[model samples]
Target: MLPAIIASSRIVFADDALDIVQGDRIQAEIDALRMEIDDLRDERDEASLDATRRTEIRRLITDVVADAEMRTNRIDRPWNVIASADGDFTLEADVIMQYDWVLNSTSSEPTRYGFSLDTLWLSLGGTMFGPKWSYGVCAAVGSDGTFIPEYAYVQHQFEDGLFVQAGILSEYFSIEQAINPNEQLGTSLSFVAGQFDAGQPEGILVGRQFDQWRFWSTLSNGWGQSYIDPLENQRTGVMTRVELKPFGDWNTLYMFNPYPGLVDRGLLFGFGGSFDWGDYAAGTGRSISGDATRATADVSWQQDGVGLMAAAYYQDVPVSQTDGGRRWAAVAQGAFFPVSTWDVYARGEWGAVENGSRSDFAMATIGTSWIPAGDSRLKVVFELVRSWGSTADWSVDGDIGILSTDGDQTVFRTQLQFAF
Candidate 1:
């Protein structure tokens, strides 16, 4: 009778394990396991099996169930490659690929269309000695096929709830800048963000999270400088950002648009400032010498399928005693999922520069995105942008790819993105 019970338990274990491994429904597998366990418990007949035999059978069943659950978790998150049995150490890999097509209304600028692997990010990140110590390394290829080192940082979590990160760290000055390009609401970042982008630089960052609020400060060679730039020409500055999350968790707050059936609601308010002193070499022999101060404020809110974000930026750079000066910009954007697989969004921007000419400008953008029901990893976006007012030269501000032009300018963009 004991041998018969053992055989029955083996059959149950084998069938359940196979189902869990092959099926994508985690909750269904869990329910099946529960039903099987209840059936085994009912087989506790005193005449058929002794108490010791029943106890052994239960132990085997528990062990097999645990193994099956672990496998299910691995299948659910394939990117999280476990490095240690205790789960204190882990490794994760991520990739982002974007292909874009653009048509500019300006006669001087030819329509640009092609697969510009603008963000070929191949990154690995994980914990080291323990869960408190972590590191990340990213290598990327730019649109022009240039090898760019993105982020290489090591961070440590102190016992006192404070954290410090050092190395070539990414920017945290603006919420727009912090978001990945592939996740941006528009085809590209706004003109304001492009002008004031605090590019990745070698720096040391310190921060702490208390309840729903957190702040981070980074001291580094200032904005527009990457890790591979010339050290002698670097602009030095310190950037600080603070955030208050009045509602949901951080994960659901960062994305510009909510996924299908997103139930986690969130509200976030953030402010950041930076001051840089020194000369920034603009070109071959042209350089701007002075001190620059910048400040930005932003707010984000999301509930279910609706999302909204607004940000404002101000910068003052007194070069020499004249000739150059200040700039301010503001943007308000919103998105809503009218259908389960479709997202519609719109954005408005206004900006002005204090330089002599008519540098005031405004841009309006409307876009739509589609994500198939079968796969959320792939996204298709189409956006139309229209701008007016006198423009400054694209060289003066890193305008991403769009060229500055006189009169009203219109651009149509289509993008296909995939990530894992």
Candidate 2:
């Protein structure tokens, strides 16, 4: 009986101790759950504060940028002197100057060396009313301080990509003549190219561009005519040109040398023709009667560090004119870069006149150019040109000097050009 009672006491004591341990464990679990809830509330508060700060920062940035854009539409430049607040009107100016030191050795004329101002071009142009309407006036200052008017025209581009301009305009037949003088590959244009180019004329031009194709036609007073030319010497003329760009940007094609960061590869083909008819005296007091027609075809290709240009020209002149006959010419030019900002180029030209004299001539030029500090605004060029064959009875551009001798002639030129 004693043993059984002892056993029962022991069992009851064990049950009480187990109940106390289970209650302590339950209290500890409840405290831990409460702490977790407190941590979640703290995190939520921090996240709300961060989101409010971010919103405020974004609002401040937006306000500052809006104010800046409203003050200046971001198109203002040193050349852009005048502008409208709504970004619809603006005015711009540009200038280019080129100086040359030339040394010539001709068989007939004594070797001579002289320095001359080649070109001083100034332009003022900008958009009016809207981006589609624009006007420009350009002029050149000769070495003798003569004011040579270049281009003065107002142009409008329609939504369908057609444009029309009226005033003093260029012939736009030869790519070499169409490019700015400062951008030419050599010191001067090839002799053959200069012979066929019609110079600038006062006229009306209509043009259209779509995708990779472009066409322009001009009805002008006549070849080599200008605003100041006398009316008695004027004649009716029409010129037309077409261009097809397989690939590449049109603006880049104007430059003979590859510019910095030139990564484009393109091929371009151009063809042009002109006709003039009247019985009038030319500006140079030369008689120009009957009809004349000029035709030209050119191609240009550029890729990587190399560029090439070639052109062929043909003209049919009135038999009444001196040295008049079917004249034809061809020119080819190539350029390559040995390094960025430096270029080496070569050009060759050949032409013939099927007249009483039947003059035939050929010219070759080699040159190198350097752009200091990779700055295209400034350039220095050195060139050596050689001409040979029957050079008599041919008139190249007067500005480049006369090649009188029939024998071979040599010329060396050093040039400095600046543009802004």
Candidate 3:
């Protein structure tokens, strides 16, 4: 019976041992062995065994049980978090697919309602020497199905509270720019933050966390700011961001907070400023030198399930080798969580060029984010936008071409996001 059982389980035993086996069938084999021992040691002595033989059976059974228990107790990590047991290296990956439908009456173009591929991308990370050192990479599909590299960088950590990253990185100049789309409450970002501030340059950034103070600074090639090959990136761009968490736990200070529970009830104050001289470089454009600078201040607070945030920014960008006027933008955003996984939010955003000398555009938006399974990685968001006032130079803000030709418009957007 013992040989038959081992044969059926495909378990090969050591020369001096019974067998080595693990996995779900282990417990069954253990139970059967125990029953055999009980029968062998019956008080009636009909099937009694010698003490030496009985001890050997118990020992082998113990080894099998221990191996089974060890295997069963091992942690099962998610598919995205790949790591080695020795803490030497790890990797993680995620895929994001998004679709956008913008229904609006356009003053510059015809009324439009259609489905567009907003974003289809991949996020991947590799850590060579543990969490203290890693690299991040992202790529997105373009309208023509071409692959565009969004981020590629290396991050290193130091013991004295300093960390550094070098790569093609996004500007740390605005609240909206600091977070990814899925981490944001609205489908569309504030016009100003999306347009004038959405520059991803190849550079290096350093950051530190001390008590409640978090500081970050960057010096980079300002990749998208130049059109000239090697000569276009001659100028270095500088940026700095500082934040203070007066009441929250330091660990939560950098969390992608889509809701209030992401951190303890508290307040945060932040500022970001940057200055660079280079052409907005990319594709097949001529590299023309120009000045680009931005400054912003923001405050955020959350208590219970309610949260509020406000930010203001000023930007001066050069175009056509001419000094363009400064652009200003602001937003007052708030959210309420009737239920922990559901939130209702509203935001009022406005932007203008150089003290409103040109023209101004103000947008009001109402939106909600729902996490059906209480998973932060999977989120569904919907937003309604109404814009009034007027915009003369759509380039005054950073909204990619969504607000290209603008006047008064209404927009409806919904997005479903998932990670891992």
The whole-model lDDT of each prediction reads 0.76, 0.81, 0.69
Q: What is the Cα-based TM-score of model 1?
A: 0.75
Candidate 1 RMSD to the correct structure = 20.7
| Model 2 lDDT per residue over 1-420, tens place | 999999999899888889999999999998998888898889999999999999999999999987777567645456446677676787788888888898889886788888888878998888898999999888999878888878889999999999999988856898988887777885677777766767677889999987798988999877755554465764788999999998987877777887657636878899999998876665556667778888999999987678899999988887666545788889999999898879899998888887647458888889999987554579998989888886665666633543666778898998898888
- Name the Cα RMSD for model 2: 15.0
- TM-score of every candidate: 0.75, 0.79, 0.74
Task: Give the per-residue lDDT of model 1 (tens digit) for 1-420.
Answer: 999999999999999999987775777788999999888777755535687788899999999988876775476456546565556677898787777777667656656554444456777899988889999988787766776777899999999899999998878888998876556775667766776677787889999998799888998877555653554564688899999999887867888877756547989999999987876565535464568888999999998888899999888867342323677789999988888888999999888876646668888899998877523368888898888775562222323346666656787888787877
Output the number of the TM-score-best candidate.
2
Off by over 4 Å in 2: 1-81, 228-234, 281-286, 356-358, 373-375, 398-402
- Comparing 1 and 2 on TM-score, the stronger one: 2
Q: Give candidate 1 misplaced runs (Cα > 4 Å).
A: 1-80, 86-88, 107-115, 228-235, 279-288, 319-324, 373-376, 393-401
Best candidate per lDDT, number?
2
Over 4 Å off, model 3: 1-76, 107-109, 226-228, 250-262, 278-285, 319-323, 355-357, 396-401
**Tens-digit per-residue lDDT, 1-420, candidate 3:** 998998856644442244334433688988999999887678446434456678889999999987765454344756567566554577778787666666766566677777677777788887887678989898888889887777788999999979999877756766667766555555656665665454666778899988788888888765245222455345667888888887876544333333545656778898988877744343435444667777899887777667678889887766453325677778888878788788888988887776444468888888887877554577777788787877556554323225554477777777776654
